[model samples]
Target: MEEILQLLSEDARLTDAQIAERTGISEAEAKDAVAKLEKDKVIRRYKTVIDWERAGIEHVFGFIEVRCAPERGVGFDAVAERIMEFPEVHSLYLMSGAYDFLVVIQGGNMRDVAYFVAEKLAPLDHVVGTATHFVLRRYKVDGDVMVERAQAKRLPVTP
Candidate 1:
C-alpha cells in the first residue's frame, strides 16, 4: 500500500498495470487496492499543480486570515462555502485560535483582492474581519523541493 501511494504520489498517470509490474503484484490486486484507497478516502483526489508565472495568470496568491462569528453550526462552514464558490478562492480551511478560517485567494492585482475584501467577504453577516497577506514566493511545496539533496549519508559496508 505504501509503495502504491508513493508511486501514485510521484506520478498519478501510472496505470494499474504499470504499478502492478513495478510492485510485483497482480494487476487485479493493484486495481483493487487503488479502488479501496479511493473508497476509503485515502486517495481523495488527483490534482495538477501549475506554475502561475508560466500559466500566464497575472495573479497573486495570498493567505487570508478570516475572523468570523462562530455562533454555532456551519457559521464558518457556510462562509467558507461562499468563499470557495468564488473563482478567486483556491482553498479554504476552518482554523482555530485568533482566526476562525484561512483562505487562499488569487487575483489579478491588489485591487482585485481589495475589491473581494470590501464587496464580498466583509459584507457577509458572519464575517467579523479579514487580513490578507500576499505570498512573495514559494520556496518548497508538498515536501518536494526545487533542489533535491543527494542521499549523501553513507550506508554500512557489508561483507
Candidate 2:
C-alpha cells in the first residue's frame, strides 16, 4: 500500500495497471487499494504544479502571518474556515509560534494583496494582527524547481 502511494505521489498520471506492474501486484488488487485510499480520503485530489512565470501570468503572492484569538470551544477551526472561504486565500494553515495561521494568498499586484490584507483579513472578527510578506520570487514550489540556475561560461585552464 505504501509502495503504491509512493508511486502515485511521484506520478499521479500512472494507471492502476502501471502501478500494479511496478509493485509486482495484481491489477485488481492495485485498483482495490487505490479505491479504498480514495474512499477513505487518504488520497486527496491529484494536482498539477504549474510554472506561472512560464505561462506568462502576472500575479503577486504573499504569506500572511495571522494572530487571532481562538473562539471558545471551536478553537482555531472556526476562524480558519472563515478565512478559507475567501477565494484569494490559496492555502491556510494553523501554525505555531507567534502566529496562529499562515495564509498563502494571491492577487494581481502589491496593492491588491495589501487591500485584501487590510480590508478583508484584518477586519475579520478575532483577527488581532497580521504580518504580510510578499513573495518576490519563487525558486521552487511543491518539490518542483521553478527556476534553473545558469551555468558559468569560462575558458578551460591549461598547465
Q: CA lDDT of each candidate? A: 0.84, 0.91
Best by TM-score: 2
Off by over 4 Å in 2: 149-159
Q: Residue-wise lDDT of candidate 2 within 1-159, one digit each (tens)?
A: 899889888899999999999999999999999999999999988987777778888788899999999889999999999999999999999988988999999757788889999999999999999999989899878777788888898779867
C-alpha lDDT (0 to 100) for residue 60 of candidate 2:
85
Q: Per-residue alpha-carbon lDDT of model 1 for 1-159, expressed as tens digits?
A: 999999999888899999999999999999999999999999999976666665677768888898888658755667777778888887888886889888888757878988887898878778889998988876675765544378878669956
Instruction: Give the TM-score (vs. native) of candidate 2.
Output: 0.84
TM-score of 1: 0.77
TM-score of each: 0.77, 0.84
